[model samples]
Target: MNTRSLLHHFKEMKHYFIVVVLVFGFSFYLGWANSASFSHFLKDQLAGLETVSKTLSNKENPQVWFFIFIFLNNAIKSILIIFAGLLLGVWPLFMLVANGMILGYVLSLQTNENTLSIVMKGILPHGIIEIPVILIACAYGLKLGMLVWKMGVQLLVPPERRTASVEMKRILHLTKPLIVGMVVLLLIAAIIESTLTYWLVHL
Candidate 1:
């Protein structure tokens, strides 16, 4: 897609993006406020993540392994969520809330002077890119979900009134560029997370 078309598509998706951001922010606040009650559940989740990290850290080239793992995990999930939006956009929305909660809970646990430093050094570098791309992917998924709902509703209307096909074509046209942009950006974010972010956190 040309820059103009891409920009237009994004403009069309601005509402969906705003919905995602709001939902994420609310969930993050909830998680932060209720961290004490959510401690056990969140700890289990964090422990599982730590296990995966440890296994990858033991690899011959841990940094490369980390990069590959992070990129694939994010790329595959982003693609899946877009399709899963066929289920009324449930998956992508759920993912956004869940991720936001986890981030909030993790930060809540950082009850130390180093909290700001950790966020700056460990998250900011990659997260600035990673978070926005993920949010955009979720917005696309939500838009697809809305389109699918319109498709269903159009069935009740006269055949001449149906615009679902046209909307679907627009989404299809944007899909190639969207996926390519998401994958490329996620790759770069993963590299930063695995290499520079790792070094800074350790230092």
Candidate 2:
């Protein structure tokens, strides 16, 4: 991709990228600095995760298992929603909101497990890059969705004059590149969530 095309791609995903920043920024300001809440958040997240892990009865290698779960949980669904939303932007909103809630809840634990610095250890290394990528993917998905919406509105209104077939073809072209970008993104996120998070929490 040339400079102009790259800029255009970023422009298309501006909204979602903005949302990612806002969410994490809000989280940091509200929860990360608070001593009590941060402690509670870590303990609660671990406790809840422990229960879930036990229910599955796969208690083989805990560190590895936790990493797998953490990375898989966010990455898989995030990728799915992004891909699906190429045709329907609304789909990823559900994933984003749901994941946001889970993140809020997890970060909000605020228990005594060294939650303040720990969260940083868990997030900053990989999250810094991965999150923006996720946001961009989501934005692209939403943009694609808007194309469909624009056509639908045109159809509902007067004469469907938006030339959707041409737009649809263009959207398909965008999908391949977008998916590649998102995959690279999620891979980084998984690595951080799995390896970095584990070490941070453990040590």
Query: How far in Å is the alpha carbon of 145 misplaced in model 2?
Result: 2.2
Q: Indicate the residue-level lDDT of 155 in model 1.
A: 95
Task: Give the 10-residue window scoring lowest on summed lDDT in candidate 1.
Answer: 1-10
Query: When superposed on Cα atoms, how far off is each prediction in RMSD?
Result: 1.4, 5.2
Candidate 1 at 92: error in angstroms? 0.5
Q: After superposition, how far is residue 73 of candidate 1 from its true place, in Å?
A: 0.8
Q: What lDDT does candidate 2 reach at residue 46?
A: 59
Over all chains combined, what TM-score does candidate 2 have? 0.67
TM-score of each: 0.94, 0.67
lDDT for model 2: 0.63
Q: Write the per-residue lDDT of candidate 2 for residues 1-203, one digit (tens) a residue.
A: 33456467667556767875665456555544453655555455457767876754467676567667756766676566656775668776654543454455556665767556755886677777766666665666666677777777677654546676567776667666666666667777777766776677668
Q: Evaluate residue 87 in candidate 1 and report its C-alpha lDDT on the 0 to 100 scale.
A: 87
Flag regions of model 2 displaced more than 4 Å.
1-7, 19-75, 86-88, 111-115, 156-160, 163-165
Candidate 2, clashing residue pairs? 37-110, 38-110, 39-110, 39-111, 40-109, 40-110, 40-111, 41-109, 41-110, 41-111
- Among the numbered candidates, top TM-score falls to 1
